[model samples]
Target: MTGTELVIDGVTLTAGAHCLVEDVSLTARPGEVIGLVGPNGSGKSSLLRAVYRALRPATGRVGVDGADAWSLPVRQLARTVAAVVQESGAEFDLSVREVVAMGRTPHKRLLDGDTAEDAELIRSALAVVDATDLAHRSFDRLSGGERQRVLIARALVQQPSLLVLDEPTNHLDIRHQLDVLGTLRRLSATVLVALHDLNLAAYYCDRLYVMRDGKVTASGPPAEVLTPHLLARVYGVASEVIVHPRTGAPQVTFLPGAPALATRVEADPSAS
Candidate 1:
């Protein structure tokens, strides 16, 4: 897949009289991985909900591949965009394979059965998330991290041009978190993911959008957007953004409970 171009133009989201997201705009070029970073209740999830069509924008448009997302048919939209959100409900009495197979529903008739390609995709997706052994086990019986991996596999099998994920590593351990984000970094599909971990976001994302108080306060490459001053302003925490010696990716080091000790730290371009 060449991936899809995503554009969120002048979007505003509201719940009753309360505004959740206001005048937000962003874009993801085809095959680019975009990261949304924010503190809790900063409207990251709400903004994502609009992109995935779970919530309608009160004022702006969500575009995928030059077409308005809300204007597309439900099945058509599903075929173009696949999302793995945080509040995945219980999947009762279904095997992991069965749950992953649900991704094929958009491409198949109600009476149709799994094809060879479908089976292969399912197998590959499971293996990608290191969940191949759990394919035969019950989905509901799995732990939170296992379930999160399975859900990601499900989204992968959908073969959409755009993938929207909210905290894909929420319940994962350190190893699994790196693996999942690494997998996303290698995908050809355009990815828009919300992350609370600044280090992971810095390493995985091609570009980052920093959100606060229902608005995008800063956005750019990881080196430009993840400054100590920005972190303190948006997240109310003191942090130092350092460049990794080997990989050269921005790494965040937080100063817990000591704002005075946290000074602006930028990666020195001259350092070898």
Candidate 2:
């Protein structure tokens, strides 16, 4: 399946009277990996929710392949956009395989059972995320990293053209983090991911959208967007951005003074 183009135009989201996202706009061309990087409360997750139809924008539009996302039917939207968010609702006693099977729901009739192709997709997804061994375990019993990988497998089985993942590496260890992010980079689908680790964002993303205070502060290739000045200004961290000789990707090396600077900024709210 071909990747879908994603466009967020002038979108604004609110929680009661407090704005969560304000006029945030960005684009992911077909088959591109776009990263959203920023500190906590930067609205990256909120913007992603709009794309996957979790939240309706107060102002502007979320477009998938030129069609307005809000105008699509629930099932249609689910087929086109798959999401793995940070917050998962209670799974009760469902098994890992049972949870992943839910992804096929959007494609099946009410009473239809899993077809051969569906079974193959589920198996392949589990393998991709290295969760095949946990297929029979109860979802509630899995570790946080294990659960996260399973959720990603569920999204993969959906066969979406566009995938939106918020903090996909949250509970993962170093090896699994690299494994998961590497899998995403190899995927043919358009990917929009929110990442906290600047180094990971720099390596995996084809282009990046840096968010601060609910808006995009910078958007460009990793090398251009992950500069020392931008890091200090947006995250209040002192750092150096260098190119990795082997991978040719930008790598961030934080200075010792970064934490103290961040602490000072936090102490004085007006400093930011």
Q: Tell me, by TM-score, which candidate is best.
A: 1
lDDT tens readout by residue for model 2, 84-203: 999985664899999999998999999999999999999999999999999999999999999999999999999999999999999999998999999999889999999999899999
Clashing pairs in 2: none
Candidate 1 accuracy as TM-score: 0.96
Backbone clash count, each prediction separately: 0, 0
| lDDT values, one for every candidate | 0.92, 0.90
Tens digits of per-residue lDDT for model 1 on 112-151?
9999999999999999999999999999999999999999
Q: Which regions of candidate 1 deviate over 4 angstroms?
A: 258-260, 266-272
Q: After superposition, how far is residue 153 of candidate 1 from its true place, in Å?
A: 0.3
TM per model? 0.96, 0.93
76: Cα error in model 2, Å: 0.6
